[model samples]
Target chain A: MSTNTTTRRLTMAQAISEATAQEMARDPRVFVMGEDVGKYGGIFSATTGLLDQFGPERVMDTPISETGFMGAALGAAAEGLRPISELMFVDFFGVCFDQIYNHIAKNHYMSGGACRYPLVITTGIGGGYNDAAQHSQCLYSIFAHVPGLKVVVPSNAYDAKGLMTTAIRDDNPVVFLYHKGIMGLSWMSYFEGSTNEVPEEQYTIPFGQARVVREGSDVTIVTLSQMVQKSVLAADRLAAEGISAEVLDLRTLVPLDRAAVLKSVQRTGRLLVADEDYLSFGLSGEIAALVAENLDTLRLKAPVRRLAVPDVPIPFSRPLEQFAIPQVDNIVASVRGLMTFKLD
Target chain B: MEATAEQLRWMYEKMIEIRDYEETMSRVYLEAKLPPKIQKGLAFDIGAGPVPGEMHLAAGQEPVAVGVCAHLRRDDTVVGAHRPHHFAIAKDVDLNAMTAEMFGKATGLGRGKGGHMHLFDPAVKFSCSGIVGAGAPQACGAALAAKKLGTDAVAIAFFGEGAANQGAFHEALNLAALWRLPVVFVVEDNKYGISVEKSASTAIASNADRAVAYGMPGVLVERNDALAVFTAAGEAVARARRGDGPTLIEVKTDRYFGHFQGDPETYRPKGEAKELRQHDPIPALGAVLRARGLLDDAADAALRARVSGRVQAAYDFGRNSPYPEPQDALLHVFAE
Candidate 1:
């Protein structure tokens, strides 16, 4: 798969739709099915033009039963149909969790490996939409804990397309989290036409490598999803103060790039984990703990700082939501906080 | 009735095996050593005898399974919910495997990893799914597969009235109708989902009413009377086999216990359960057979004893079976 070098521009949503379309085109059995996925072309338009292209049988529009359609996707896969089921909101995962965990995850092992239930379950995660209680949530950690399930969390348009393609092609069941906020994010170089454009041909990017979005040696800021953008802004602010900060964008959560994180920490001798979810059990907390517990090679550093929302649900009000999520200012304050942290 | 008297006897024996095995499971988990949840949900972990856990026993639901399974061939598949003992028995899965699964042993169905809520037995073409209203679509998938393979083997999905509210029910019924995919949708209205009564849980009094939305035939049956359920299921199954499309069969029955073991159910009106007890299917059928001169006390007693012995054996096998190994636990994520 070659990267597009032209000046053609597209949003993250467009990239994802392109990847899905290419995969479905490559495999006749690969079909798209979900609520409003056909005629409506998905709630966020991620499935645009598929219904007309593939017709109603393949690009199916399903009733509002995540559990049923989700299970059907796996069962169909077992019967030799490559299916991609969509969950409109990742927060609504509880209703159809059985099909995902029980039916899809355990089918092969239960039958003694006589089957391959390949499925790409895509769902929209994260909040900046003011969708309130049930609509907005980042539950990757809950899914990340499950065995036999691969999780992909992309921070940019290019990675979003490539990682999703990889998830679709995976032999095991995979969950791809599409951040709502990043769908419309402006990529300065690619989508903005200021830099190279994505190629039109079929391609996919590998998972687990953390992209060093902005390089600096004074301190390292590790984050993922939309938080990566916020970390970049924080780094820019730190640069103005001559406190250079390195920012790492964790494209995937499950096969986490620990080596990159450790190296960055060792180089900078200081670390700050900026996360979208609650601070206590988030990926950041786990990363910081791993570094502190085993960072004997990085002895010249200060205690790792973490910039995560306290343990609380995402509130509805704008201010409350801001307080519940890590913002650019929060990252800046956190980077400043780590300048004098002492573990000893 | 084209089948011989021996086939009928075998069907009855399978049903009885499920019943007696469930009783054995209850005894072991309760008075013997297991918990009620483990005992009740054992139907899934083991071969599909009396269905277990969180959902009520299909003790009274066995005849539905027997009568329906009586029609399906080996390639034909069936999907069931939490209380799915009857379907497992109908499919003829290994009793020992079902029991071992219930105990979370390696030898069990799904290597004890599936637990009771997620039972799978490819042998009998029965897969016990725990998701409420989840199995219907999978049944549709199986039917779609059979159709694609040009096989007349119809897939039947047995669920509850509570699941009729689920999105899968609507999606599947519509698909089955649109494609004539050879599927039968049986809704066992067991009267409750946990404490939510069917009358309270569903906007429509009967799930059969929802079938109108799919532009298909939806019928209500008396679950307490096995003959009625048999007759309804027969027509529906036949219609699906003939490629006429899908049928929604809602069997109205009383669950007879709290939603689960130790539920201390206090929702029903006083004596409502007592009033429903007189309509129990087993005795009702027994009375019918006696009046028709088709049953003798000696034969009936012999059948019960035989069923009890077999169930006892299954219980012994599951109880003595070794637990799953810790390292081997990771095996089989993907089938080869």
Candidate 2:
């Protein structure tokens, strides 16, 4: 049934840049503004070749002031302009948090529906290379925790394009967190399909929808962003061990697709949450708590296990950072533990 | 620009209307603070009225709102500070809806979600923030839109002297000047931010002095005189319309009431608030009109009565408006 669908191979960076370009072409009100987004073609190349196509007006390069530019985006959104603001890194949310949290997130609510904030704050997240603590961290949950902002983290190039389109079209503020490791940059090594087959046509993947990447019955591994790739690798190892593992990719964290998760858990009877964010009070904990609340209905065979970064800043050293972040080996271990659980 | 008799009278009427509305808000807020009856074990009866939460009254500072907003059109925007009642009124935001919002009524601007501190009127392009200096950058955005859209519409940002110290404020000024956005940053120097005096907080004697660093005109107006404020705002608005970037105008104003209703105000000298009231711009505006022969004793009395009646009607509208269901809070957080 899917054989007729036409697609082309593209990297996650290409998919995102194409999505933004298409949106900007379609809507004059939609424009891209951020540090190094114009002449620099974006440091991650997510905005490469956009400046020449769209010109300096549409593809803007802001000063090194996140708060100033982000706040300007909020105002422009409020004034009926669709602004796609790029915060260079997710870790830099600290300086401009007031604009994002207090203003951008609350404008629609605080204005009593009088205002519609059509804003997309796209930022790079996750750490694989030695970018150190500041540059490498996936804090999607921090944005998801706040109300009024829709949080989306795409697993592959196909999902990246679709989700970016949806985020641009969304009237309320949407936080588009793309993992740097999954961008398929020449400088970075990523798994297959990190740059996958994507359709050229503009399309949208609705927020709060989860995709079952690899379906299985023995266990369900829930993860998102680059971790989706890692979880799939772990599932592969579990499959080799004669244990079926289902990998669920949560495309968006806020407006989370809890139904898809519960359905997977119901079938698998065991669940393992792998998150790249901080373990305590984060995506993993939230998922575990969610499943725990539905234990009676879902009828899990055992308690949900979580593999995430320990409660510490990402380390500078490669060994410490690797140990701190969740890895495929850790996911395999957690899934193995889940398979060995015996109900009393 | 010299103020004509008609224009002076109009400014006086706006100032008086704001004064009356703020005074009414103060009375209603004080009533909300009353203890509950013995039948209820609650210290304060939540059911007594729809009005709840803090009230930041802009009483003596009516001249700032009146003057700045007079230069703004419906399409032009104004982003205000926490003390936004006067600005909302002067910008011609629907008084009935604003009052209803203060009462937490369903008909309020935010459908009873945002109270006085966060009133938003899209028709007038008016919005305020509870956070200090948060509105400055936003105002620049609006001005950017106008500039991009090739419209002469300018944006005004209303903040306090204390907000001048905020990083957002400096960043906004720098950005506006850099981009040459049509925004006028109006700092209403009400002398106090909550309890912290401007002297203790800000190092600069005048917030306007910092405008030179951003390469924009800076002016200090006699805040108590509506004519003086109006003249200063006129020049800034013109400069912005002429694509001359932003201007910083510091209006040396005063707030007759505490930062919020029910504040003990122990930080102030015993008679400071009362003494400041002697320089209240509402009456000063009326005197200005009288001096110009635009208003007589009978006309002044008639204007005050009409303003009081309108304010009273707004209060009645608020009292009659329905409070939103608890579930309504969950709505409007996302777009439909």
Per-candidate DockQ versus the true complex? Answer: 0.34, 0.80
Docking verdict class for candidate 2: high
lDDT of each: 0.74, 0.89
- TM-score (all chains, Cα) for each model: 0.80, 0.97
Worst 10 residues of 2 chain B by lDDT: B37-46
TM-score of 2: 0.97
Residue B120, candidate 1: C-alpha displacement in angstroms: 0.9
Error of 2 at B195 (Å): 1.5
Position A43, candidate 2: lDDT = 80
Q: Write the per-residue lDDT of candidate 1 for residues A69-134, one digit (tens) a residue.
A: 787787677666678889988988998887787677767766545456788888887877667768
- Clash count for candidate 2 is 1
Please state the CAPRI-style docking class of candidate 1.
acceptable
True contacts kept of 2: 0.78
Model 2's DockQ score: 0.80
Across all candidates, what is each one's fraction of true contacts kept? 0.49, 0.78
What digit string (tens of lDDT, one per residue) describes model 2 on residues A274-334?
A: 8999999999999898898888887778778988888888888989888998899999988
Poorly placed runs, candidate 2 (over 4 Å): A1-6, B35-50
